[model samples]
Target: MDRRRVIDLEEFADELRRDPHPVYARLRAQGPVHRVRLPGSDPDYATWLVVGYEEARAALADPRLAKDGHKIGATFLDEEMIGKHLLATDPPQHTRLRALVTRAFTMRRVERLRPRIQQITDDLLDEMLPRGRADLIEALAFPLPITVICELLGVPDMDRAEFRKMSTEVVAPTSSQSEYDAVVRLAEYLTGLIEDKRCSRPTDDLLSDLLRTTAEDGDRLSAQELRGMAYLLLIAGHETTVNLIGNGVHALLTHPDQLAALRADMSLLDGAVEEMLRYEGPVHSATFRYAAEPLEIAGTLIEQGDHLVVGLTASGRDGGRYDDPDRFDIRRDARGHLAFGHGIHFCLGAPLARLEGRTAVGTLLQRAPELALDGTPGEWLPGLLMRGMRSLPVRW
Candidate 1:
């Protein structure tokens, strides 16, 4: 009999936060799958982390790994607040939710925002560029997507400062009780916001559309589903893109060769954005997927009821999938990366995210030609879910 290896991620929380790829690389050397305990999780709970690219792709679409919150029982966050969204459900339900949201988040609709996205980018840079130095995360990364998503959803009165606090707590909770409290507060805020939207003047916003839109079969989002959808859109919309811009800029500025190449030839912007996503995507790992039944991944047996984490970051940097996986090369053939995930649960806001990333990075580089890291970034966000620095200080 062999003893199974246990990697306590909580033990190396700080190190992993700063640079998870190195740790994931070491784990990949061991095997494709490892049993690990995430930071802030209860001591006894463990999840299977799929680090290999092939394995991760398969695990993401594995039917045996269920996304239903009921399958995993009670969690740190309130079920009503987080459940019933696209990521938390499987098939039929997921299929339906995706369909409804997609109608509003269509690529055509996102494309229409190109002008607005560019304007926002220019306006933000206009304000920050004059200072010659600023925390890029604050000056650009965080606000860009939050502002876009809020307007898109018709959330006119949201308090970005306070909402950000609640959103951060919901995603990267410091404790179980803290997460519960945050979710409760967020749920209350969202509920109130939805009601306010209802009472206020009608507007041409996604949320307003969602309120009245229904399927051919007359399937419309329930009040709870509406809240769940709003929570997902608001948090995921801002959180993922913020990190994408922040992480993408950090990657390029650190890799002078890549940055220089991009600067010399603007044609590489698309590939650079793809490479940024592959190299350092916003979401490090997908949310929890519990085993619906006994399953095997990369030859490792996973018992029923066991939890699993699809390592989006690890999969992107899998040595087996790409040459020099750790090196940041904007020109690499970076297709097939699982940065936005795979199968039915692919990020609904991917188009908007890409639009924002391309506009922000391209415009920033064009405006601030001498942009460089001004100071060491603050600690990385604490959690396996979101991969981002707390703040990235930079100067032109």
Candidate 2:
């Protein structure tokens, strides 16, 4: 890497994890795209980090930036550990996988899940509030989504602590060996779940539905594909919401005025959730997209086989997108934010995540009228991929 051309992002990792907007602003001031070396990556190699709003938005959907690493003669570790799931594939395959999954994961289906989501929220809060003080992430944020998704996937009760460990290793790994072990364990677990579903009578769950789902031309997800899909859905289904609730609540507690405004008018629930997604979304960047062919984005020439990340957090702070983008106002009309990303790979679990966020935040405030930060929020999750706390202590 040319010292003049490559920006060393590893130097900014600590600051980015603590508070990324300042770093994002600094990068954006220079330009939308930059050759940056991320933490744990080869110093000699660099990735194009897209930070500008318009550029990030367009880069997300641009087919030239292929989601399939294989197209560029490479593959992400998870894709190899699991298989070619939606985030790891381009059109044709993605189109097919999406269509089948969409049939089961419809908006109408999500709407029907509101009552159960609320019940889960109420139950979690009921158990948590009486304690007077609790780590919000452990007591609520993490459990709610995990419970909902586990039930949705018809996964039988298992060691959740173990599961979370594996999931974290895959997403925000501390070591390569640990990550590989986690992937192997998770892949094995998912494979078992698939086999169980395959042998057992069909159930009213996404996993079982995927097992029976077939296309007009008799195309069905093979066993390996089912395992991959299960791994994707199970992980993506809850992890995003876990951070959504954690990050959103932390934002609210930190900004008393916004928290007060939200309490005054519960009607702001919808807008507040949207604002949460915009202000401090769960993920900093969408999954890496590779340059399948040479292309230019925001005047930066990206050669074929180049790896890049679209900065969702950076885009949300772009002055070009929202006036006073860094402010934490719940009433801001934050539609079209790249929090859930843009285009085809936009989060499929977005509706579910939004619903859970709305229910979790609104219910928490209503129940714990005196809810406040018990202490400084714990350390943020390591790595730039996820933006959330390892713990957020709070009290009523």
> For candidate 1, lDDT tens digit of each residue in 30-148?
99999988876688877788999999999988888888858767353556655578888888788898888777677888888899989988999999999999999999999999999
**Per-residue lDDT over 27-58 for candidate 2, one digit per residue giving the tens place of the 0 to 100 score:** 99988889999877888978888999999999
Q: Which of the numbered candidates is closest to the native, going by highest TM-score? A: 2
TM-score of 1: 0.96
Name every residue pair that clashes in candidate 1.
Answer: none
Q: Where is the poorest 10-residue window by lDDT in model 1? A: 74-83
lDDT by candidate, in order shown:
0.88, 0.89
- As a whole number from 0 to 100, the lDDT of residue 385 in candidate 1 is 89
The alpha-carbon RMSD values of the candidates against the true structure, listed in the order shown, are 1.6, 1.3
